[model samples]
Target: MQRVLIVEDDPLIAIDLQHMIHDLGYVTSGIANSFDSAKRLAPHSDLALVDVNLVDGATGPRIGQFLAGEFGISVVMVTANPEVVADGIFGVIGVISKPAQPATIKQVLEFMSTYKHQLVAHPPALRLFTCDRRGPL
Candidate 1:
């Protein structure tokens, strides 16, 4: 099972995401409300569902870049303002507009599991980002 880390500031949303991840048969590595907490849990995570705005301000993109570039973890931004990361960040696979539906999350996980973060045909619910000239790796 994929070990997922929820990088969201809202406790309620984090809890809901945790439950959804569990229901989908994935492991909840941890939930982090700030960049410091997220860094601490990055090593143990396989994937991260991140929010653009957090308790520490707009640090989700940085978190995603860090986790994906440093730890080789797959990163997906889940935020109310998807436009913030519309241009994309290094190591981030894509952006999922909030509120993300259960079906969308499930499909995202499945796609990530199958592709292992490779740039390929992605789920329609996910807005793919152009991480680099070659695309997300």
Candidate 2:
């Protein structure tokens, strides 16, 4: 199953994401509220729900980059930051708006579930496998 990390400082949001992941057929791998903790914990996830603004600062873009670029974790940036700054999250599969709707969340989770690799400390570096390539590749 897809393993997910929640990098949201808001406990309620994190818990909601956890519940949603369960409903979507994934596991809650970990949760972090800051950039440092997210960095340490992200490598363990196959995918991540990253908030652009953290309890400490705006670290979601960084987390998104690190998770996707370094660890091969599929990052779905969940934030209210509709600014172009959202464009900076390289290697990210999607940029989801905050207060995620069940429909949108399910869409992203369904996107992730198609991949076959099991989540571990670090997923294998297969660029295509690590990405969301549509339509029977």
- Which runs of model 1 end up more than 4 angstroms from their true locations? 117-120, 132-137
Over 53-91, each residue of candidate 1 has an lDDT whose tens digit, in order, gives: 999999999988888888888888999999888788877
- Residue 58 error, candidate 2, Å: 0.5
Model 2, residue 31: C-alpha shift (Å): 1.2
**TM-score per candidate, in order?**
0.92, 0.77
Error of 1 at 132 (Å): 5.8
What is every candidate's alpha-carbon RMSD to the true fold? 2.0, 7.1
Model 1 misses residue 98 by how many Å? Answer: 0.6
Q: Which ten contiguous residues of candidate 1 have the minimum total lDDT?
A: 128-137
Q: Evaluate all candidate structures by whole-model CA lDDT and list the values in order.
A: 0.87, 0.70
Leading candidate by lDDT:
1
Model 2, poorest ten-residue lDDT window? 120-129
